[model samples]
Target: MAKKKKKDAYIDPQQRELRELIELKKMQQAAAEHPEEVQAEFEKEEPIVPKTFKEKWKNYWYHYKGLTWGGLAGVVLVVWLIKDIFFGPEYDLSVTTATKYMFSALNDSMSSDLASYAEDYNGDGKTDVTYNEITIYLDPEAENVDVQMNAINLQKLMAVFAGGEDLLFVLEQESYDYVCGGKEGIFIDLSALYPDIDIIEGDKLILNDTALGKKMYLNGLEEDVFLCVRDMGGSVKEDDESLSTMERSLDFVENILREEYPDKFPAEEAPADNSSEEAR
Candidate 1:
């Protein structure tokens, strides 16, 4: 017996996991053999405690995905709102035009002519003028043009029709006729606004609708396309100070037309002086 000395068995720290696994397997085998005993033991053990709100939230974040995306979207929307409110560009005025022909030529001419016409109407030193374009398609029924006026486009059309003090529209012939058909509020009487406009001058482009009580400038190139300006929302009063800006803009338009399409729109001719001709 003295000669028989027990040798200590050494186990590595990493091998402790294997020993635990074997112990678990033995327990599982015992539980399978005595299911009733294992069930009673499990029932006797304390029930799992409910997770706190913080712990539950941590678990939820570990599993759920849409909530994280929703949070990010909310943050982006808030930032956009702040930026729009504080740093958004402010337009002194907006001009809307409807064209039947391709606008490339007219656009080039306009851009070249109006390049230096930017004015500080609001005394803000920045020129905030926006040019908007609308394409008109001929309607099959009435030989008039039709626009897909739905959603945002419809809202924009209505806003221009409403005639805001800072907004103007240069409408096409068929479009102008359709808008002025009701003569409700879509057009501002240019004659009333500028008594000296000479809209019917020979060298000037003009169109008349006696029934509709409207007269405007026709496109020199296209007979069916007319040019006319109306206050957006038609709310510009005769005595409004902004009328001066409107006048200047209209004059600018006339000058551009006269310059760009000189062949089509020439200078007005001087009337012959028949009475003075006898002295000659």
Candidate 2:
């Protein structure tokens, strides 16, 4: 009790009232000096509504430009895909190759040589031939042993097959055997398509020694390579369009086989053979 009385002896009631009064005076001075700020604090905010289409659009874009542009881009992409896939004419020929020797899609050498045989099948007044390559390192010593790339190539190959029945395939002998060597129906027998030509053995069209092959100058093709056409006789996807396309493809193949090169090849057939055996 004596300690409590001693603590209260130092307490100042006047000091506590003075401190409160000082704070109240400071707030009054702030309100007096900055009345607009005080008024703004109590002001009711108005929701702005645009009166015209232009103003509305501007305001809407200001708030949702990202979504608007993104949606527009998505719509354009969808429209393009729809037009390209369904309505667009298929390439005069689509080839899926499982060898390392085929030309890149960008390189027009092989396609150009092959194009000489293409018959404007789509009536587009131009011959369109496209090549899709599957990266299969059949060689044991190949260093590019990427598993992800292998999967992607496999997926691409399956998509090719799924897209149509009348297509071309350029493949290695081992890979050919893995696909449809013993099987007769899966791959069209080239003998039937190019019966008059001699370079074909069953489904294999010996691409070498042909005019097209000579033009291609398939170098680094260390192993036996062949060109094959997918058989559409038993294909479930065969439709009227595919049937017509296959007829044109057969004609194209026949033309390529019929193409001839002279024994004493023209010296100008190529810029003097600066190519070594690897580039032959």
Q: Which candidate is the best by lDDT?
A: 2
All models: lDDT? Answer: 0.55, 0.71
In terms of TM-score, how similar is model 1 to the real structure?
A: 0.43
Q: Model 1, 142: alpha-carbon shift in Å?
A: 12
In model 1, which range of ten residues has the least summed lDDT? 209-218
lDDT of 2 by residue, 1-280 (tens): 9999988677699986888899999989999999998889778667688999999999999999999999999999999999989997667876567865545653566656666777787777888777566766555677758777766776676666766653777777867876664876877788774455567888888876776655656543455677777777544366887777677767777676555533322323445656586576
Model 1 has a clash total of 10
lDDT of 2 at 250: 73
Model 1 spans > 4 angstroms off: 1-85, 100-113, 123-128, 136-152, 184-221, 231-234, 237-245, 257-280
